[model samples]
Target: MRKNSSTTFVFIVLFLFAALIFVFRMQLVGISGMITNFSRPLQAGLFSVFNHPSNETNKKFQQVVDTLVSQAQMNQLKSDNNALRDQFATANIEPSQLLPSRIIGLPQFLPGISLPEQLILDQGTNQGVQKGMPVIIKNVLIGEITKVESATSLVTLISSPNFLFTAQTQNTNTLGIVKGEGADKVVLVNVELSDTLKIGDIVVTKGDKNLTGKGLPPGLVVGKISAINKSPSALYQSAAIQNPIDITKVSEVFIMLK
Candidate 1:
């Protein structure tokens, strides 16, 4: 009986070994495709688990680099501005006396008839800005402060139809009234026909001799004459003057206190 039991166990072990050999042969005969198909999802899962965090880390490092570059540029601008202020002091022109301000508000056109003809500044009476104060950018006259509140002011652009200033031509020293003609254009009217009023003549502010020193500084560029309209019958010649300032691009300005 013991011998019979031992024989049955040997037969069972031999049958299992034969089944394992058959499976190995099937894998060698192109049935390995099934094994590969079973492993595809596991391979993708391992890739996602390991690579996703690395990609996120790379993106975060790029953002940090961008922020550092922007900060460096801002620091450079501040340094250059300080140097400019010191240079102005050397010229005996008290730049410290001038109030530097930035444009804060721009014209926002709505669906209706509302249009903004002026700019809003961040400085106002609280910052020593007053009405009628000349607003300039880099020594060029662009406009004047028309209204001053406690913390803000309104600037009437030189392109406004109601704005006017006394201007003189550089070559001829001929005086004329520079008046805004709307649409970023000005006209030098009342120029005598005999004067050397020609196209391309540069115009500048003609200072006044009033007691309160209310006049704009002389030599502040107004614009250059682009066209000259001369008529034999008319007593005075009018010329179209091009506005030097592109108001849309203005970001910073200064108000002359003295």
Candidate 2:
């Protein structure tokens, strides 16, 4: 009976081992599908902690863009200031030529038939600007001051009706008085009917002390001789000049501070 018991114990031990193996295989198969449910959440939590940024990404991007925009604006302002400084240096040496100033008012691109063209500037007596100063546009003399305030001034064109300039004709080297002819034209008076005087003769300022403005710069452009009278010319006293500054389309002007 003891031998029979021993054999039965051995058989029970083998069956238990086989049953444990089968249960283990079944557990492994069951865990394969639910393994994702368990491991994926843990993996995602770790990734959030280690891989992703804790701060707002969009906000950071906006800050970077704003910084770049501000830098660009500052650069533009710096460039503008540098250009103005260079212009100032050039203007000071030749104060009679032009002084850099701002356009405070532009009454007309093309004002009207009744009203003459006019432009107001931010420079006046405050910045050494004085009456009769020739205002230049892009280095070309365009007009003269009509009025002045403490910090502002008005420029009237040489094409204006009441304008006059003493000019020296290049052909004859003779002096003449240039008076406006109301329609972008001027009269060069006291021109001798020499063989030198002809159509297309260039006219420039004679640079006399009295003919220049009281506080204005002289030797600026007056006009060009567009036509001349002949038929033995009846010994006329004047020649017609084509004014240079087109009064209808002036944008910027520099006031001379001589």
Candidate 3:
């Protein structure tokens, strides 16, 4: 009877060992799938902490984009506001007298020279923008319209080497032709050597008319004289004129009707 009991105990131990082996094999085959089912509620939380597209990361990226956009918008608003103020202050001119237009395009290089000379406007013949009309930005003369289309027009910037306009000194009241020297520099020519054009003297349009009878009005600020070059051997004195406004930064302009 004792021998029989020992044999039964050995069988029982063998059966338990076999069961343990089976359980281990099942876990090895489907361990990953079992864990996913068990932790489904926490899966999203784990991914957000470890992945690149987390909520925190998205918020940070959005903030950076918003800052950049806000800065750009603020700059544009300032420019527009300044333009409106200039229109109101200029010669007490009514808004109906001035035609507002945006620069649609700018040339890569000026014609006949490698400089920024030309720009295109959104106005055309339909808007009464004719060739040779003066283009001003904030009461300052920038260029003249050279070409006209049905819906667009081309402008020649005063800084171009090919551009020339009649200007006069404010303090001395001297008349001279302002000629572009490339690189945003201009030279006042044909002034008498004895004329007193001092540094910091303001220059403005002379309102001289062309054969077409259209001309820029007097008292429109052009630039300021920065240097004077007088030669005893030369017939007239010349000076370097500094433009007040940066042409590259200009976006909108006014086409004077008169």
Candidate 4:
């Protein structure tokens, strides 16, 4: 009776093992698709419940990014518009609308050290630029067109040693020749000691009397009087001008060809 009981238990165990293997193989081969079909709705429902807040959070983050980008673009547009307005205000000729360009190279003239701070315009005669054209950066006088080419030109900076301009004192109404010193300094030549020229006086071009224009336009603000020195012989008084335009920052300019 004990042997019969043992045989019956072994048969039951063998049958259970065979059934387990069959179920596993069926799942691997064909039942996998069935299991996915049955579980998809459950998975989707669980995701909706758990991920709804996360999706909203992601949308908020994206909105923040979009706001930042829009602000940056608005700032850039405002800057560009301000620059354009300045160009229009300072420009002289209707056709000579102050166009923008990059400084590709430094001004090269024979026997002079060019100041890179003074801008060199990229467009030249090809862009209707001509000799005697007035070049200005941000409404300040820089230089005038000296050499013209099909695509390039040389601007004679007012700070050059040989540069000279006929400028009048804003306070004194006194006219003198403004000549560039070796450095960035300029001298008000032949000014009389009694002419009432003083330090901190503003200087501007005497357009009607100016000869060279010194790479500048008539009536443009040149600089202020920084210092006044007298001649030992009392023959003349020399004054130094403090230029307004920071040459180093000159990037783009407008050429006014009359």
lDDT (Cα, tens digit) per residue for candidate 1, span 126-242: 578888888876556778889766566788878788688888876667899999866677889998888888676777787664687676666567777899999989999988987
Task: Work out the TM-score per prediction.
Answer: 0.59, 0.53, 0.60, 0.55
Candidate 4, residues 73-136, lDDT tens digits: the string is: 4443554577688875432323446655544444334313434324345566557877777676
Q: Across residues 217-244, which tens digit of lDDT does each residue of candidate 3 receive?
A: 7656677799999999999999998776
Model 4 residue runs over 4 Å out of place are 1-97, 107-119, 209-217
Question: What is the descending TM-score order?
Answer: 3, 1, 4, 2
The local lDDT score (0 to 100) that residue 29 gets in candidate 3 is 27
Alpha-carbon shift of residue 161 in model 3 (angstroms):
1.9
lDDT of 2 by residue, 1-258 (tens): 999999999999998987997877554534443553454445445433433322465445446434533443444355457769887532122334468865545453343443355666666566777777778754345678888665567787666676776767554566777776555666787666564666665565555555343533434455567776654646745678775454433334577665
Better of 1 and 3 by lDDT: 3
Those runs of model 2 whose alpha carbons end farther than 4 Å from true positions after fitting are 1-97, 102-117, 211-218, 231-233
* Each prediction's whole-model lDDT (CA): 0.68, 0.59, 0.70, 0.61
Give the range of the ten consecutive residues with the poorest summed lDDT in model 3. Answer: 43-52
lDDT score for residue 146 of model 3: 88
Q: lDDT of candidate 1 vs native? A: 0.68
**Candidate 4 C-alpha error for residue 175, in Å:** 0.6
lDDT of 3 at 214: 70
